[model samples]
Target: MKSKLKMKDEILEYTHKEIENIKESFCKEYEHKIQAVIEEKDKEIHAMQKKFKDLNEENTENKNEIAKLGKMLEDANKKIKKRDMEMYILLDENKKQKEKAAKKMNKVNELLNNLQKEYTDNIP
Candidate 1:
């Protein structure tokens, strides 16, 4: 009866040790799974951050290009205005020259008529 009791005691001890080993293994596996999930999340976060950064860079580039185009348009507008002013000046100069030419032509016609009349009177 004492031997049977000792054998029962040994069996109980073995069972307790087996239970503890199972618990330890379960804890380790749970820790490993949690660590893997954390690593995956870290990778995802980094990827998201990089994507945001790239988008920001693209946005900045687009803004700069827009600004450049706006500046170019402004410059072109200035040139067009300058050209318009120059054209107006040239047109005014041309009008003045035409008036001068018409005056000169009228004077020459009067001189020709006077010369013809003088010659006709001298012959008579």
Candidate 2:
């Protein structure tokens, strides 16, 4: 009876050890799967960060180009204003020249009339 009880105890201990080993193996597999998921997420995050940086660079370049275009537009507007001022000055000068020419023509007509009157008086 004593030998039989010892064998039963050994069998129970062996079964318990096997169960514990199987649980440990399952835990290790779970940990490896979790680590793999974490690595994949890190790679995805890195790619997104690089894309965002590229977009920011592109945005900066666009802003610079817009600023250059605005400066060019301002210069063009100044040139147009200057040209308008010159045109106005030329028109004023033309008006003064016309007035002078009209006055000279009137004086020549008056001189011709006076000469004709003197000749008529002498003939009579």
lDDT of each: 0.98, 0.91
Estimate the lDDT of model 2.
0.91
Q: Write the per-residue lDDT of candidate 2 for residues 10-111, one digit (tens) a residue.
A: 888988889999999999999899999999999999999999999999999999999999999999999999999999999999989989988887888788
lDDT (Cα, 0-100) at 104 in candidate 1: 96
Tell me the RMSD of model 1 versus the true structure.
Answer: 2.8
Error of 2 at 108 (Å): 4.5
Candidates' RMSD to native: 2.8, 3.4
lDDT of 1 at 86: 100
Give lDDT: candidate 1, residue 116: 90
Model 1: per-residue lDDT, tens digit, 50-114?
99999999999999999999999999999999999999999999999999999999999989999
List runs of model 1 lying over 4 Å from the truth.
1-13, 117-124
